[model samples]
Target: MSAILEVENLRVAYPSRQGPVEVVRGVSFALGRERLGIVGESGSGKSQTGRAILGLTAAGGRVTADRLHFDGIDLRGASPRIWRQLRGRRMSMVMQDPKFSLNPVMTIGRQIVEAGRRGGVSRRDAKARALEMLEAVQIRDPGRVFDAYPHELSGGMGQRAMIAMMLVGRPDLLIADEPTSALDVTVQLEVLGILDDLVRDRGMGLVFISHDLRLVSTFCDRVLVMYAGRVVEEIAAADLDRATHPYTRGLLNCLPRIDAEARPLPTLERDADWAR
Candidate 1:
């Protein structure tokens, strides 16, 4: 498949008392209609890179890049008007927590309908399409789910509903940030399965960002390991065990194994140079 998104020499920084605190430094990557995983610890700037691509950085943060393109359109410093045009229709983001992402007072059905309406669907058509998406995400009672409020649903249900809403726009690219981190293990796997199915069925490009190395390897096609705002390693998901970077190796060593003998959990050793 051709490249759907591309980033080159991308940098994001925030102003501080002393000077600029850079989060992402010269990050570069290209994504096709396949799954790509970004794995890193807290404060590694993995999520910042994703937001920068979507033109959704924090107020004080600044993003600079030589090239940021989506389907041959340059996105570097693109106007807000263009972003609004593409965001919900051609591209969408699935945030980690639905409780915060979804409107508290809006009906689930109404929210999904609003999402569909961004693509110019009529209200009736939007509602019907929303119901269809709820079913696509494996919600058994689409009508009930549509009528309920975000607060009335469980965590898993809400997340699935959010997924359904995100897909209602039929976006070509979906950026999922720690999408299943708050769910139980069983629910997490189920949600991941739903994402995989969507990617396969719709040919949508996926950027799965999370801290769990094992989960990313299992759920994604390729993995990019981040350390101190920089991509330290890139490896195939199936070959993540053989990662050459010290940081990647440390992350692998730290994961608990089902068959391993009981022992002290390993910790990642950090060096000052890793921040550079």
Candidate 2:
């Protein structure tokens, strides 16, 4: 399959009194129209890598790449105009926290409808699509939730609304950051089903960033294990157990097992060289 997103020697650094602090250190990968999961602990630069792809890096951060291309568009020097045209229409990101992704004052309906409109849907169609998305995310009383503001809903409810908003538009590439973290198992399965259908049927490329190792291993076609802003291992989802990297083996060993005798789970031993 052709690549939908490409990154080579991608680096993200922020200016600081101490000097430039590199958050993403020379990460590289390619994504096709399939699920690609990035798994790591907090502060592992998974979120920052996704943000850089969407041109949403924080202020004063510097992003440089030998090549960062998305469907033939070079993202290294892309202007605001280019981003405005591409984001939502061709690509969209579902942020981990709805509070950060959604407009607190705007009703969910308006936000989702706006996303649909940005994808070139008519106002009437946009409204319909927005409501359909709300229902798809397993929100009961879609109408009521649609009219509610971000702060009015619970964490999980608001997250579902945000997912609804992001999926309202037909994006070729989607970067989902811990999207199902706030959702229940049932709802998580439902949402994953939707994502699966999008990839299988609509041929949408997905970059699924999460801390859930089991979920990624099952859902993603391939997996990238990151540590301290760099990829420690890249392995097929099915072959995760065969991963040779010490970091990957350590992480797998740490997982709680049901069949095993009750005992304290082994913690990953840190290696300074893994971050270098």
Top-lDDT structure, candidate number: 2
For residues 138-169, could you state the per-residue lDDT of candidate 2 as single tens digits? Answer: 99899999888888999999889988888889
Candidate 2 TM-score over all chains jointly? 0.98
Cα shift from native, residue 239, model 2 (Å): 0.8
Q: Which residue runs of candidate 1 sit more than 4 Å off their true CA positions?
A: 185-187
Candidate 2 Cα errors over 4 Å, as ranges:
none
TM-scores for every predicted model: 0.94, 0.98
- At residue 248, what lDDT does model 2 achieve? 87
lDDT of 1 by residue, 92-168 (tens): 88887898889999999999898899956899999989998898776789999999999999988898889888889
Q: How displaced is residue 57 in candidate 2, in Å?
A: 0.2
